[model samples]
Target: MQNFLDDNFLLHNDIAEDLFHNYAKSQPIIDYHNHLSPQEVAENKKFENLTQAWLYGDHYKWRAMRANGIDEHYITGQASDKEKFLKWAETVPYTVRNPLYHWTHLELQRYFGITELLSPKTAENIYEQASAQLQAETHSTRDLLQQMNVKVICTTDDPIDSLIHHQTFAQEQSSFQMFPAFRPDKAMQTEQPQVFNTYIDKLAEVSNREISDFQTYLDALKARHDFFATQGCCVSDHGLSHLYADDYTEDEVAQIFQKIRKQELITTEECNKFKSAMLVYFAEWDHEKGWVQQYHVGAFRNTNSRKFNELGADTGWDSIGDFKQGEALVRFLDRLDKENKLAKTILYNLNAVDNDLFAAMTGNFNDGSVVGKIQFGSAWWFHDQLDGMTKQINALSNIGLISRFIGMLTDSRSFLSFPRHEYFRRLLCNIFAEDIQKGLIPNDIPWIGSMIADICYHNAKNYFPFNDSAV
Candidate 1:
């Protein structure tokens, strides 16, 4: 059979094909946000085979298997590699309309030169061939990343991590830059004060200081933030279901932390006060440093406690939250904007109801200093799909200029998922191609191609100055 990756699958749109081959092929990937381990990139680890890379860490497959009534033993349990591949193969035919279908085929075609469809019938041949290539040094972790043209990556890290890998990777690879984001979710773990206190003690030990007071706690976390900065990190990330922006006096906040430290059952109002102050303080610092701050709001995490403990967090146990996110978030951002301390911000929403709200909110703080000083980030996590991407794109376009849009990121734990960018680029090209075909955009190939390149590559480069080349 002929290779599916041959000239035949180049593209349906003549202009799209030309643009990808001519321009997009050479531009390196700037994966600004991801959950990849810096240690793997630093050490340049080699995978055992294709299944370990594709199946071992991919929770997407786990979700699909659970939905198909496959036991956890087959999904991620003690199943052999071939057995896992067999199970995955059996499930593939039913994955139509899911992004996995496109991602699996796209990777096979683009990376492995595979022409045959992946199914129970072709499972053995496909696994054997892919496994063989995986044995070569060319398929090592760093090599895999280079193959995807990844030039820079920012890993989501907690405030407590050592970040030794980030420092080592920086000294070793000038070609690819890996940085850390100072995520302090546990610091705000007010729901579990005991856990929060334990985390604080560990943080204090790491920072080599006593965090007896709230200021000391801030200093300790800020010390790590400064340490992150030395290794070329210019971004901070926060994940919240909604903003906590109620104003509080310094006395009230101090008492709140006192109650937290004392392990007393604090009122919801006290928790809100502490969280609000902490959020404001972080926003102020991020603005002071001229960093890009990301807020991923509207995720209701840890919905199933049993699955959470058995399978651990982020195992498809999170759901869409429906808190009153609008007025509070707008008030918070408005405060920052009023004080001119609102750093370049990116807002991501899980609920589609807030798409228009986020879009309009982004434009509200634009200030006209840059084309995209404020942005509603690409649909993330469960929303990184055709419909989600389209709604987000249309929302941003309707409110602001689509030409200035920054494109997609993996938001994945899997290494092979870099093809997500290709998925996004193709979707973008098709959108533009359809527009041109209908005369909504002119038939000028170069102009439309340039627009496509902007969204896929150049715009993100310009928007985030932390892209390796910018560094």
Candidate 2:
């Protein structure tokens, strides 16, 4: 019998085990960046069963199920819990080398102690066991976080959110630390005038300021940014199809704002200009606040407009978008760096080729104050698989230094996803071991393992705001 968690199991050397897990004090996982629901954490909700816990909110699984010829009725529809679980089980066997396969099995092993491989044959029995465990207090939301040694978690949030649950999480100080990241993507729109106006009104109410135009909108956003700072927020997040670098003047933006309110459509070029200006302004604010900024680029969100209108955001409709990302990203980053406005930053891209782009970009901005100051963030969105992580790690090793890479974020909406950290850890150890064994890397077990642990857990503590300790 082999322990999936055995340190040397993946790396295949008894000596490596002692190095990696030595002081493996996973007391709490500071999930610096994720998309978890604050309301769920606040209530400490226990899942009804496996389907409710695993499938209810996961867009990743939903997309795969849809791709494998399953229907909406069976997925996110009125199918029995057992039926949905069976469908997912059928899909699991197909997920093979995909990150989903590793994540599913690792979580099953970690939380339920069920090591039997998931397949159509074992679906019913496995589902019954998992459902039973998922119903227990040990499998409660907060406990699930605790099971993964997650001590702190930061949830991605929009500018207009009430943050009531964030306040609640702090007041109670549950095992998982829930902080907020200021994501302001919707504010940069030149499309959808009606939605923008409604959003502006909501933003004004949240920040207690009235917005008449562009300047006022910026002011309201600034006020909210300041408020987030007053609490414990130390990161801001942005998501885009690609980087925008079109320069625009304030006067030009003024007219755009007017058209925006009147529900007039702006040209794509003009929209790019406005969005570019907005993103730069946001970078300035992040710099002023000394906050880390995260950029997740290259997602073609909502490709299937028909399904989008029916199921809403993050159903199976989103796919990877192709765009020339490197040049514009350079312009935007260089613009910030030249002004000394670059904060501690993380760059993520869905496309794997950009791994080199991100790694090389980090070198462009390391002004010697910090070693690897700007990080190429964890493999994110569609690219968080073992292969993706390997590509990212290899790119970093070849271009930048992997030892300095701050690695592995769950980026998931599920608490069951904590096993992803382990999956990343194993992959990391194996990469290093293979390198050492092949004489590609030095055979220094203790030093290599220490570096591996740092990548797995230690480095993130210093990389993120774990030292704030306000909660």
Candidate 3:
């Protein structure tokens, strides 16, 4: 029987092992999208303990712990860090088939050199060892990223952000690079008039502009976008339940914005129209600046109202949403393509049911201006695990060019999450090897290995304008 997490962990064949070890393993990572803190990296922050480094702000572990009936205190409340970690250790054994099981051990082994499985039995010893290492200078945030061979990290940022951390990081000489990704979701969020106005006020303050009208608001946001470019941002991201493509004129959208500014509640139809207009404006700006625009859609967030009120959003209360994506998605892209304003776009769907729909959609607007310009992004959020990754890859391979595919990202807040890229690479190599064994593909190691290397790193390097000397 195969040993758990052995050298050939996810590699199922001899060819798979060879491809991973030789081609995929050594490629430097370009984590194109993630929620990592730029401040931590800039400061080179070291954790006081394993829990602070692992469990803090990690909703994935919180969700698992909650499933195991862990109390709120141990999960996210006022419990001591050690007590929280102990609870997590007690719950780890029950995570048998979950990806967290594999990820927990992989992180321990890779970062702390601990090969023992985590459980109640080993928790104390493991925690002590890892915590001690975390306190070391070599285990600081920057050092951890270096150890993982991460070449670039693009952190999510609000348009109102000063990007002071990114600026600070840029001044230092480091092997890896960090850049900001402009995420302007709040700029168009009109669901709550008070909240939207508050955000607009912040935007106005940051951009040093007056926002008396919709035109002025756009001017302020555009100024922020320009400032983000100065700080080396070349990517933009959006989080949405689904694409909005409602047909509305500029005058109507302006009036909706005015109502929002006056702290008046707009109807749902107006909200959708405003969002649709904002998306088009953002996409046009991205195209003008030669930036890549990403949309992560189909998430039904904050389902637990009580918990959301107590803990706020992104505390693991979100789930995959079933939304009608086809028509709106097509209309949105078609609108941009028709105007020649479509940026290099990546669409990530949280729901697995739309895997084929998303994969096939990319084909409609390739235009050959760029290779794989309209990409179905890597499996995201709830779909970032083994089964989900495989399904996404299979769908993309069947309908799109997997060779041109930019590969895995952590999409996580933890420094230790870089191991997810390794997991993805191994799975990818194994898939190709299995096809060769089945005589479905040629046994051309050199050719297939090149493709693997591209998917692992090179594709992203070329696709993103990261190496632009002007930046």
Measured by lDDT, the strongest candidate is 3
Predicted candidate 1 versus true structure: per-residue lDDT over 1-471, tens digit per residue? 434445524355776667666655556677878888788878887767678878887777878878877778887689888898889988998988888887888787766778788999999999998888777887777877878888777899887788899888767745567778877777887877898889989999999999988889889988887877777778888999898899898889888888889988888888888889888888888888888899999998889898888988776678788877889878899999999999889888899888999998888889987789888999987788888888888898888888888788888776778888887776677667667777887888788778777887888788775844542
Candidate 1's error at 100, in angstroms? 0.8
Winning model by TM-score: 3
Model 3, which residues run further than 4 Å from truth? 468-471
> How many backbone clashes are present in model 3?
0
lDDT of 2 by residue, 370-431 (tens): 66679988888787887888898899899998888777888888878887777677677767
Best of the two (2, 3) by lDDT: 3
Off by over 4 Å in 2: 1-9, 12-28, 468-471
C-alpha lDDT score of every prediction, in listed order: 0.81, 0.82, 0.94
Query: What is the model-wide C-alpha lDDT for candidate 3?
Result: 0.94
**Please, what are the lDDT tens digits per residue for candidate 3 over residues 164-272?**
9999999989989999999999898899999999999999899997999989998998999999999989999999999999999999988998898888999999999
Candidate 1 lDDT trough over 10 residues, lowest sum: 1-10
Candidate 3 clashes between residue pairs 3 or more apart in a chain or in different chains? none
55 in model 1: Cα distance from truth in Å? 2.0
Which order, best to worst by lDDT?
Answer: 3, 2, 1
